[model samples]
Target: MAYRVQGVVVREKDAPATIETVIVPDPGPGEAVVDIITSGVCHTDLHYQQGGISDDFPFLLGHEATGRVSAVGEGVTEIAVGDRVILNWRAVCGQCRACAKGQPQYCFNTHNATQKMTLEDGTELSAALGIGAFIEKTLVAAGQCTKIDEESDAAAVGLLGCGVMAGIGAAINTGEVKRGESVAVIGCGGVGTAAIAGAQLAGATTIIAVDIDDAKLEQAKRFGATHTVNSKNEDPVAAIQALTGGFGADVVIDAVGRPETYKQAFYARDLAGRVVLVGVPTPEMQLELPLLDVFGRGGSLKSSWYGDCLPSRDFAMLIDQYKLGRLDLDGFVTERVGLGDVEASFAKMGDGTVLRSVVEL
Candidate 1:
């Protein structure tokens, strides 16, 4: 039997999302049905509303979620009914070239439910990030369910499902930040601030935060930034160099993703230092750097896809840290709201009023 649930859905390009009746079918083989407890509103959800992600109309618009498995399908042994889990998009296929090489974080093939959740009239709604978790309950592959400590706060730790995890992973995994290293994160949004916290967690001695917004810069300080630079009034590259003892940082992460910020990150690192680009860029955006300068820099320039995170490994570790009071996952939740408030939260998110507005199901 299919369960009737309410989900936030975008019906057309640039259309505001609305609550609609979603038909969540019983899991098929290798699938599980999750009863969502909480879901976080991310910029990616807004991007779906604005037609930035795809032309897949009627997209189910949430992914960062925590849920309990309510049912499991045949052959689904990895997860069982009643498991507390954090939803993840990367359900790595072990045979994929990336996974076979032991880099499951770069898995080229991930799994989703073989069955589709539909509208009352049978229109198939595209699941955002392959999770479609804005609804009361969602069906997903069993591998998508990563079991975590049930005592962890659902509203807060669910962020590990996406953006928060991306930021932390960008620092810890992609950048491979080392103890006593000097690190600079460009952008003080959710991802950038998380990078600051991740740097602290990784034992970085100096963390510099660069942003145009003074308020955000201040917030970054709470996340363990040692110094804040207002790029609006100063040359950020020069400022970073000056702060790092006339040398640049060991690692500079571009969290804003624009060409200008990328340039700043490129030049804000010490010779042979790493620059991690965790921010998502549009398809139309082209990066043109001088070939000689690229060779002259003599450093690694890498892009972080999903922060190079291996969810099965990272999620549990992060949840345990949150429980140990070592990580401030709660700091990321700026507001708690009901499902209808998601559209309003989008406006606040645009104006930088909130880090994340989460929907508590």
Candidate 2:
């Protein structure tokens, strides 16, 4: 049977997200219905409201979520009802060339539920990041659910579904920050701080956090940054170099996703060091750099899609780490709000006042 639930939805560009009656149909083949416990208010959700992601109006927003399996449809076998899980956008299609090559993190063709959630009038709603989790219940591809330890807090680990995972994966998976290496993350937002924490876990000896906001830089310290650079007061690239004894960091991640920050990441790394871009940029933006600088920088320049993570592997491992007190997933949840507060929470995100405003369902 289809379920009726209230969800946050943006009807048009520049419109405020309002709670709407969403129709979540019973899962079809290869789909599952989840009773969401909590969902985080991520920047991506805001992007959907602003139409920065697509022209698909009537976007069912919210993606970072954790929930319990409530129902499964035909042919779904990997997960069962009552299992705790984190939702992931990238449900890899194993037959895709990227997945067939064992690089499923870069799966060229990801999957979502074939069925659509609709408005009361039968208007189709595009699920944000293909999950559309800001509701009491959501339908998703069976593969999109990754079971995790039930003991974990739904509000905390739910963040692993998106921004947080991207940040951590940028450092640990993409940059491959090794023990005792110097690491710098530009943009001390939720994603950037996760990169710092990831670097710390990977044993980065000197973790430098650069951001325009001093408060965010301070918050980065709790995430294991050894030094903070207020870019508004100093040149971040220069500060990063100075902190690393004028040699530059071994890995520099651009989490701000602007041309300026990308250039900073490009120049802030040591020779042969890695630069990982995890920040989402608008299509109107363009980047130009001297060809000589590209050649002079003899290391990898990579973009992180959901932190290039394999959810089945990374989510459970990170959840265990959180349970073991090694990873601070709890630190990411700044405030807990009900679903109705999503718009107000979105406003707080602009000032970097909260790491996350989670909607606890």
Looking at model 1, residue 204 earns an lDDT score of 97
Model 2 over residues 1-361: C-alpha lDDT tens digits?
8899999999999899999999999999999999999999999999989889999999999999999999999999999999999999989899999988999999999999999999999999999999999999999999999998767799999999998899999999999999999999999999999999999989999999999888898899999999999888999888999998898999999999999999999999999989999999999999999999899879999998899999999998888888989889999999999989999998999877999999999
**If scored against the real structure, what TM-score would every candidate get?**
0.99, 0.99
Error of 2 at 44 (Å): 0.2
Task: Give a tens-digit lDDT track for model 1, residues 226-258.
Answer: 999999999999999999998899999999999
Pairs that clash in candidate 2 = none
Worst 10 residues of 1 by lDDT: 279-288
- Per-candidate Cα lDDT values, in order, are 0.93, 0.94
Write down the lDDT that model 2 would get. Answer: 0.94
| Model 1 pairs in collision | none
Give the top-scoring candidate (lDDT). Answer: 2
